[model samples]
Target chain A: MELVRIQKQDFSVTEEIELVKAVSKSIGGVVVFLGTGRDISKSEEIVRLDFEHYPGMAEKKLQEIRVRALDNFNIIEMGIVHRIGKIEIGENIVLIVAAAQHRNDAFMACEWAIAELKRITPIWKKEITKKGEVWVEEHP
Target chain B: MVKIRFFAMLKNKVGQEEVKLDVPENISLEKFKQILKKEFPAITEFLDKKSIMISVNQEFATKNTMIKDGDEVALLPPFSGG
Candidate 1:
């Protein structure tokens, strides 16, 4: 069983790696994805980004995603962390880690988890650009 | 009784984050929206014309769907998260 978290604090890669190692003793592979704030959106320069979420609901949704991944994939461990509040350019936004007995499952599950998170999660990000602040509506 | 929640832009338009409605048993989401509009006229502008998604008990739902007491309903705006 893996833990899922949605918070406003920064995460350390070392801590995440250690968590992955501790959960899956039989793991043969680990896959991780880090989503970061980018400097540009649709050819405009971004200054800062603000993320807002429906607090309790957002956590519940992330837990549901974690459960769905476990039910759909043959993975030993999985964990996801999403950052909230204001963030600067190049800061970490989200992180996912999947560990499985095979390399293929680990990679595939990680991708699926992130894709589903983007599609279904209620958290929204607003980008403050040099031109103006715009609320992003879709991941496209 | 059912509790409905609104988030993001929808929340801003409705000027409320959540509301409790004493709906008749087995009321459809469409009728619920009507009641909401009547109760909160400010929401009419957002509900009548804007694109909003519904979730029943945290899962996606359509307007024709029926809801029960104690059910949790949510009106979501266009998702903009990574």
Candidate 2:
């Protein structure tokens, strides 16, 4: 089973990992990566972050990453979720769960999925600092 | 008419989420973008800097990609998601 979602509501990482783990009995290991809203960015105090996405295309790109990871890695299933709208500091921003028959496969796939998501997903974040708000456009 | 969508900083620059344009059928994506740049000068910097990307029907599109009436076209800036 594979799950890909873009939502404004926060999600439970444990629950998401459990759902992926339940997909196969032979799955021996699971790796999860959680991204939370940070209070500081580039030495500036960020009060909050506002995330925006390109609607249909954002979800489509995420699903594409999941399918590609499953095909390229030994993972049995992958779950990905990204939160949108206004997010306060320390709030959950994204989650990725990778389940595989071995720990190395899960670890590698989980890392690759997050990197790919950052690279291709049509999502953006604006840093609401004490001074002002600025949309983050630099990928490097 | 084809629908042109904008997201992230590009949306803010364009001052709208989406707009309808009476574009010629089978217009190359490059030409369509040229028209857009002429129409919305605010986004010209992004287009020139190559910071913007075009997607047709929710997929990445190239300059040679052909766009037709009723197709969904989007201008996407760099992705920052984790």
Every candidate's DockQ is 0.63, 0.84
Q: State fnat for each of the candidate structures.
A: 0.69, 0.88
- DockQ score for candidate 2: 0.84
Model 1 lDDT tens row, A32-108: 99999999888888999999886677788788888888889998888889999999999999998888999899899
Worst 10 residues of 2 chain B by lDDT: B45-54
Task: Please list the residue runs of candidate 2 whose C-alpha ends up more than 4 Å from where it truly belongs after superposition.
Answer: none
Candidate 1's TM-score reads 0.85
B4-78, model 2: which lDDT tens digit per residue?
A: 898888888889999999987899978897899899999988988776788999999987799998999988888
lDDT of each: 0.83, 0.90
lDDT of 2 by residue, A40-96 (tens): 888999999999998888999999999999999999999999999999999999999
Q: Model 1 chain A: which ten-residue window has the lowest total lDDT?
A: A1-10
